[model samples]
Every structure is written in C-alpha cells, then in structure tokens.
Target: MRVGDIDISYDDQGDGLPVVLVHGHPFDRSMWAPQVARLAPRHRVITADLRGFGETTVVPGKTPLGVFADDLFGLLDRLGVERAVWCGLSMGGQIVMEAHRARPERVRGLILADTFPEAETPAGRAARHAAAERVLREGMGPYADEVLDKMISPTNVRALPDVAAHVLRMMRGTSPEGAAAAWRGRAERPDYLDSLSRATVPALVVVGEEDKFTPVDVARRMHATIPGSTLAVIPGAAHLPNLERPAEFTDAVERFLATVA
Candidate 1:
C-alpha cells in the first residue's frame, strides 16, 4: 500500500479482531511468520514492512519512531482497523509504544517482544552513528555476520540452522541506506517509561532469557512499569525469541491474547 512518500509492503491474513505485528530493525515482516500463522487461526493478522526494510521503499532520511507510528496508523486507517492489538519486536516494539503514546485509543492491547523503552546512551548513540556510517560506506553483511550470534544465542544458532541463515538473508537484503536511516532513527528515540506506566490496557512483554542486548532485567523493568503487562522470558533464546523458539513464543502470545477479553 502507498502511504506518504513511500510504498509500505504488508500481508493481511485471516479474519477476526485485527492484530498488527510489526518487525524490528533491518528485518522484514517475514519475521512474524510464526506468530501470524498461529494467531491467524483466531484473529486477523496484519504483518507490514516498515519503511527502509523488506519490500518497502527504502527512502533516505531520518525515519523517526513518531513517523513510523504515524505510518502504521495510516496503514490501519486504510485497512479500516479502528482499534487493534499491536505486537512489536525490537525497534517495532518501540514504535508500538510510540503509537500508543500518540493515540492510545487506537490500541486494544500491546505485545512488546524483545524490546525496551529506554533512550540510547551517549556511547550507544556514538556506536549507532559509527555503524550507520560503516554500513552506508561498505555494506551490511559484515555487521550481520558479527551480530548473528548476538541476535540469537549461539546454542540456538547451532541448534536451529535455518534461523541464523534466515537472519543473514534478511540482513544482507536490507538496503544500506534504509538500515542506516533506521539506526539513526532509533538512536534518537526518547524514554517511554513514564508514558508506558500510564497504560490502561493489557500488555504482554516477551523477552529471550539469553538476550544480550535487551536482557531479562530490561524486560522486568518494562513489565513493572507498563501497568499490568505480563513478562515471559523464552529460555535459551536471545533477542529474536519468536524465531529462535517459535512454539514457546506462540504459546506465550496465545496465553496473553486469551486474557485480553
């Protein structure tokens, strides 16, 4: 669908209460295949490729979380989804929080998976800038290779052969400009703890037990702050728990959705 200055790629499946699944940095909507397949049985599942990732147009310039949230809203409005369950992973999770902050009434519930609400630290900001410069100058393959194990546990990378390969494919396919744009966008994100604390709806915060980036401690803090959000840690998985432990991840999500009504 064409939204704003870019064309957003999305997959809308099944039929019931709408549930929007947003993917994280550098990856596309395909990351939610497991969740989409499982949730579609009981609810409408919409997976979208945000700007600069997947089949979406890789427009240059900063894509702020607010802009991402607005784009999501535009997609939902076009689809006639007045209010729906929002499930976001990594950067997508931050977008979900931003969308809720902008228009809480449009969200029925939230599923923040493998994500955190904190702003980038001084060093983190510098590192992101450096990464962006490198990716833009050279390519994304090197960074993807270096971060594969960090994205998912080394044990899972060896145990589930396809997951790592899939991540590599996604990372390699990403537009360097898009990747840089997103990295810069995320670097500027503000802390959402205060806003998340005021949430009135149900939320499920899922994290990987072995996640190095956003560890279990981050998940616990988000759980404690996000009103009545449930926290579930997928044992032996890392940042991308959904891909690393699909069955367990699906169960955790299903458990949360069951309590929504």
Candidate 2:
C-alpha cells in the first residue's frame, strides 16, 4: 500500500474487526508471523512493515513517532479501516501509543508487548545518539552482535535456538541507516505515561518474564496505569515474548479481545 510517499508492505487477511500488528525497530512485519497466522483465523489481521524496515523503502530524515503514527493511520485509511486494535512491540508499541494520543478515535484497543511509555532519560538520550553513531561507523554488525544475546533470555538461548537465530537474522538484515534513524528518532520521543489515563480502551500488556529491556516491573506499571488493561508475562521468554512464546501470547491476546468486541 502507498502510505504518503513510501510503499508499505503489509498482509491483510481474515474477516472480522481490524487488528493491526506493528513490529519493533530494526525488525520487520515477519516478526509477527506467529501471531498473524493465529489471528488470521479469527479477525482481520494486518501486519505492516514500518519505514526503513522490512520491504519498506527508507526515506532519509528524522522519522518521529508521530510521523510513524501518521503513516499507520494512512495505511488504515487506505485500507478503509476506521479503527483497529493496535498491537505493537517495543518501538512499535511506542508508535501505537503515539497514534492513540494523536487519534484516539482510530484505536479500539491496545496490545503492548515488551514496551514502556517513558521518554528517554538524559543518559539514555546520549547513549541512543552514540549508539546511532556507532552503528553508522561500524555498521549494524557490532550493534547486532551486542543486542542479539540481550534480546532473548539466557534460557531461550538454549531452549529456543530458532528463536534466537530468527532475531539475529532480522537484526542483521535490517538497514543500518534505517535502524540508526529509528534510534535517533526514539531519543526524541515524548513520554506517553502522563496522559495514559485518557486512553479508556481495553488493553493487554504482554511482556517476557525475563525481558531485560522492559522487564516485568514496567509491564506491571503499564497495566496499573491503563484503565482496565490486563497483564500477561510469558515465562522464560525475553524481549520478544510473542515470537518466543507464540501460543501463550496468542492465548493471552485472544482472551483479552474476546471480551472487548
């Protein structure tokens, strides 16, 4: 689909209410294959590749979360979808939150996985810019090597070899320029926690029990803030719980969605 000047590659299947799945930074829509396959049987599942990632061509510039949200809203508009349940992980979750903040009427519910709403702290802002510079100087190899192990829990390294390799491939294949752009853009993202009370829609917060990035505490905090959000932690999984524990993640989402509409 053509979203503004860029072409967004997406998979839209099934026949119920729209449920859009957005992948994290440096990753593509394929990360949601597990959830897509399962959700396709029950609802209108849409998985999209964000700019600079997946098949989407990179447009050089600072791509803010608001811009990403606009692209998402545009994608849905082109598809004739009025509203959808926004499901996102990590960076994608931030996009969903921003999109909801910008256009609350367009979001039916939220499925935030391994994500948080706090803006980057002073040290984090510096690190993100430095990381972007490092990636540009050394390419994605160093960054990929550093994050691969941290992306998944130690237990998953042995138990889920395929999962580990999957993330590695995604990271390695990601466009360095795009990844750097996202990292820089994230450094400028605003904190969404303060106004979260205004988001009255049903939400499901899923995080890996062993997630080093967002962890269980952040998930609990998010659940407590969102009006009536449910929380589910996938045991032994790390950052990408949906990929590591698809069945459990899908089960959690299904139960939550069943209650909403």
lDDT of 2 by residue, 127-235 (tens): 9888878877888777887887678877787789998888888888888788888888898989888667778899999999989899899999998998988899898
Off by over 4 Å in 2: none
- 27-88 in candidate 1: lDDT tens per residue? 99999988888999898999999999999989786778998899889998889999998999
**Runs with alpha carbons beyond 4 Å of true place in candidate 1:** none
Worst 10 residues of 2 by lDDT: 57-66
Clashes of each: 0, 0
List all candidate RMSDs to the true structure. 0.8, 1.0
Best by TM-score: 1
Pairs that clash in candidate 2: none
Each candidate's lDDT (Cα)? Answer: 0.91, 0.88
